[model samples]
Target chain A: MLSIRDLVTSYGNIEALRGISLDAAEGEVTCLLGPNGAGKTTTLFTIAGILTAKSGAVVLNGEDMTRLRAAEVVSRGIALVPENRLVFPRMDVEDNLRAGAYSRRASAAEIAADVADMYRRFPRLEERKDQLAGTLSGGEQQMLAIARGLMARPRILLMDEPSIGLAPMIVAEIFDIIRELNREGVTILLVEQNARMALDVAHKFYLIEGGRITFSGSPGEIEQDEVIQRAYLGSRQG
Target chain B: MIDFIQNTVDGVMFGSSYALLAIGFTIVFGVMRRLNLAFGASIMLGAYMGTWLHVHYQVHVLVVAVTTVACTVLVGIYVERLCFHAVRRDAALASMVSSFVIWMQLEEAAIHLLPERTYAFPGLFAAGSYEAGPFLFRTEQTAMLLLAAVMVGALHLLLHRTRFGLALRATSENPLAAAYMGIHRTWTVLCAFVLMSLAGGVAGFAILATDQQITPFFGLWATFKGLIAMMLGGMGSLPGAILGGLLLGVVEAHALWYLGAEYRDLSAFLLLFAMLVSRPGGLLGQRILSREELAFRRV
Candidate 1:
């Protein structure tokens, strides 16, 4: 559903993503694995239009959407559940969901219905519908953030670090939710520092390091290569 | 005893207008983490429209106030567009002069229109004053107090109960994050500015109703009180602004009554200085920008 070619992004003097190119097929999970400062979030931000690209093209379903603003990109059916679960911290859970659905022109009744469906799926969110998002637990906040993104009604959902700093149980739960979401046919572009967990679920994976894509292949091929393993794991141990 | 009570009531009533102005001023500062100097002018513009409508159309006083408030909101939107929007990336104090320039322009226009003659606004409150010792309360003063309360309540309810209000509150805390949530950065800010300007306009009308005398400087007095209130209340906290205004008003009123009127402005300024020295974070303001928030935007 999404394709990128020669995408170069910079922040001031430093180059974040140096001439990177990748593609995600329709309705398939594409995971980007990287260590810190490896340009994982930068790629997502560039594609989501939060950061401007110095040069390159982001083609979504054959149409170039590289130049669109974040809000415009959302209207084109792209939503990013950003790093750090940057949920609208001060807004109520329900309002956060409403904010997610902001890009589309949904009627009040329709919005209510979508919100109800979201609440039904994520009951924790429904329970805390009126509470400030900032006060929610890290896991709950992450779930709320994802649920809020879903409210955007995007075709391709880009998630950055869905498992960072989360407990083992919560991380498992989040991955299960992602798997269920994918099974139900929502295309996902998940950026994970949790490489072992990412490799387990992702159909195809791309490894990024030092602002460049050094490898792109299936999980089996990536796990087989000693050099690829070193680049991904950073220590070929285990 | 009666004089003391009356003075306190007067102070509280006067404080209400100051509170509204302070709230408006602090709100923009809190959100963008920058002082919106043109804010005072935005209020004056609103006030001018309100009184102008009254002078021209012979509309009801309450209606005039509403019209004035609405006009200020438009001014707020315009100021946001022409002033704050462009200076976001420039020096922090780049827009400070924008307000002074607006103030001068407004002063010039008012002088031209009034034409070297002092003009008195029509007093809408039916006149009657209750007296006790050195303090007094006129029907107009009472009316001003009641109406100010109603305005504050309405403003508070709008902010707490509405979805747009929550978005606004969120914007005040973090504009960048608000944008990520699909809230239009410019629109949300414009909404806040409009609301603030409306408050300023209503304040002008309310003061005018009390026969407080409408010079070009009426706006300046209200703006000064607002700045003091912002310092007292901890910028951007709703309840805090009200308390600060009321406290400053009473302090000034007391000074006016006891220490003679010469001490009124000086007293208020000194009080604000004391408050600032004691609690630099402001009465309820936390996480405020220490240096200019706009300048901290090296990113």
Candidate 2:
């Protein structure tokens, strides 16, 4: 389980997240949805310890991880699949997966086995295992990024905008992977711009806008709500 | 034909040291994306430290080289932590300023310590030239060449085989991406600095052995020759730098033998300029990272 309490984050003078609080239950797909500049990525960055919060407590599995550095946060079993799938450009696909396990305490053999497992789950990656990660198609790179996060063997996976720039079919494929990942017992907290798809995959949903969460509820309950309709779909019923 | 052959041999031997200097320069530039103008000063510092060790303590030449390199690494790391890291966030001006400040400080310090005086560390090889047909090869030059080859070979192994070396290469390609993957940014930069300083220390010994001098200003040619080679080779490519250093040496040697010794500098410059015009990226220089890979976004 992960708990973010009264988190406030700012980039210089611009407040991206203002005193927001949320929880991501274990093995559940919790998706945070918001329009552009909704502090969604900021929330993820704060939790991953890439961006520091001005004031808040980030409790992951009952430990305070608010002030930990990104690498240290990773060592503590939290891996971030950053937005845009920032895989190393010049590195081979296999090497990128290895980098995912960078902060792990596993043996090389164990890591290799885990990689083999990933290759099994994502056969496309296996097909292009020796190819440069940068040259992979956008969808493939996104898959590689998630697989890389899985390699870290993190207790909780934080994915930011994995479907941001992909085609609809590719986006569906990504969401399906997220669905499968959740079913197979990975605790996921995904930030997404695609409201309908994110709601379909996530168990719990949080609506964020202008650096604060306006609503949080079960996907079914929130989807029926008027504010949810307006906030996400920009209700323009004639 | 005999004169050409003799100059080629001499150039090949002398170019070894220049190649080492280029490797050091290119390694730092590749990783940090900053030019270390003071790096020459680092060489000067290593030379002074090694020579001081030999002159005062009568330490073995190997020990002098090792300890001086270690000292330079510490200096490099200290500079990284206190100086470079702070401004690292700025990207454009910080590292350049960091290198500039260190260069100025080292220049002042070197002046205070040695004051342009050239003192030699005792040569590792006996003083004699062995005859090859009618051409005589100096023993010290041959030894220096062997040492240069060893440094280059050792670096090749380190960069290709070791985890530390891979990490350095990755950092050079992209620092932010490396950080997200848990590669310590400071460690990568420090490793680069240390590698260059090792080059510095070896250069000190090479200069001392090859020539009979150790002055504060001794490394200017090393910097110029090495940089020119990197420019010719392509800034980011290792193999290119090696080839470029050899090319520079060959051109200079020919000029010294046939075109008159006064044209040595001119010949080297001509070669470098030709490379710049013909292959602007050097032989192996990597262009800037792509926007998609870096995940570029406008603010």
Index of the highest-lDDT prediction = 2
The superposed Cα distance between candidate 2 and the true structure at residue B82, in angstroms, equals 4.9
TM-score of chain A in every predicted structure: 0.95, 0.96
lDDT tens per residue, model 1, B224-273: 87888888988777778888988998998899999999999999999999
Clashing pairs for model 1 are B31-B172, B50-B68
Q: Looking at model 1, what is the TM-score of chain A?
A: 0.95
DockQ of 1: 0.43
lDDT, candidate 1, A122-189, per-residue tens: 99999999999989999999998898889889999999999988999999989988988899899999
Model 1 CAPRI rating: acceptable
In model 2, pairs of residues that clash are: B119-B214, B233-B282, B233-B283, B234-B282, B234-B283, B236-B285
The parts of candidate 2 lying over 4 Å away from their true place are A230-238, B1-10, B57-59, B86-88, B128-142, B288-299
Mark the regions of model 1 whose C-alpha exceeds 4 Å error after superposition.
Answer: A12-15, A167-169, A234-238, B1-4, B45-67, B115-117, B129-137, B160-163, B287-299
Error of 2 at B197 (Å): 1.3
